[model samples]
Target: MSKPVIIIGAGGHAKVLAESLLRGDQTILGFTDPDASATLFEGIPYLGTDAIIFEHRPEEILLVNGLGSVGDNRTRQAMFSSFTAKAYRFTRVIHPSAIISHIEVEMGSGCQILAGALINPGARLGNNIIINSHAVVEHDCRIGDHVHISPGAIICGNCTIDDMAYIGASSTLKQGVNIGKGAIIAAGAVVINDVPSYTLMAGVPAQQKHQLQGGVK
Candidate 1:
């Protein structure tokens, strides 16, 4: 008797999330997209715009923006806020193929953990976080809200990644490090110390390059 769920987007990520929901034994009530003209995706219908969610008032729904890096993620954040204001309950989506350690893990709502991502025990992932393919969050790490751990990144144990931080592909965070809010670690950067807020750090050993103001690079 799993609750019925509504998917918010109809793009590639939505397709993957839908499959994960199905595998989790949740009933997917189809997707809502402004551009939807097709009858269905993966055997589920495209149910017009997002207004249908308010109309239907399903007991449980998961909203996901399938767009890749939606222009600094402002749009996705707004949508998430709107849904929260509307009293919609969001659920986390974890792919069945992912390997989660038996140790304590706290994952917030609307998290999408992709296949091959390894979440070790004692890790805490905040709301709307994306642990992308092959990313590894070692034990005792705290990942803040809306943080995106890109593919192949490795965060060592006891690290704290603050809200809206982006860990680029193949980057590594050393043990007990703190990455500040809205910080961007470039691809292949190796972090050994604390990264300040709104800074963009890159290269091996991760030197600070510049500061970002209000998501502007």
Candidate 2:
């Protein structure tokens, strides 16, 4: 039997997630969002608020966290933790168009690897991560939980990105660079150094713009 999936957000990212799931031939039960205006998501029904998950048995349907993190990933992480506490299991959504090389790749639950993304061999991705469209993860990279490697971002070989880090669109991280937890790498920035925790790095060579005290809000 095909496992039914309930998507947790009804936004643009949810549309992408829906398309990925559909391409994988997975059955989608519907979406859950607080926005009553969202009656339909990419032609999929909106199954009311997120509280609706309590109505279904967790074991019977898997969850897909459609909430995307532009900077702060706490919302996505919170949703995953909440659902997990309720004994709900999450599904990893990988687009058919994505290229996965013959490498030892380990992915945690609730990850979304989008179309045109390339995950090289010997890479490890943590829970609730977003490898957005056309993003490239080179060999031996480690990406942490709730990290959003935005569209077209290139993570070079042997890089380490810690939890809740957001690498903006088209940004490139040099090989062997370490990005600390909760750091934000700006769009188009080229990172060549280790970023400190909760730091905002921008510009070419990626200087620290500011420290995100207490992390992203």
Per-residue lDDT of model 2, residues 30-74, tens digit only: 999988788544567888899998999987899999998788888
List runs of model 2 lying over 4 Å from the truth.
41-43
Give every collision pair in model 1: none
What is the per-residue lDDT of model 1 for residues 1-217, given as tens digits with 9 covering 90 to 100?
6567777877766777777777888787778888867433557878888888887563555555454452155555667778888778767788888888887998888788988899999999998888887899999999998788888999999999998888998999999999998888998999998999888899888999988874438
Question: What are the lDDT figures for the candidates, one per model?
Answer: 0.81, 0.91
Clashes of each: 0, 0
User: Where's the lowest-lDDT run of ten residues in candidate 1?
Assistant: 65-74
Q: What is the alpha-carbon lDDT for the whole of candidate 2? A: 0.91
Among these predictions, the greatest lDDT belongs to 2
Best by TM-score: 2
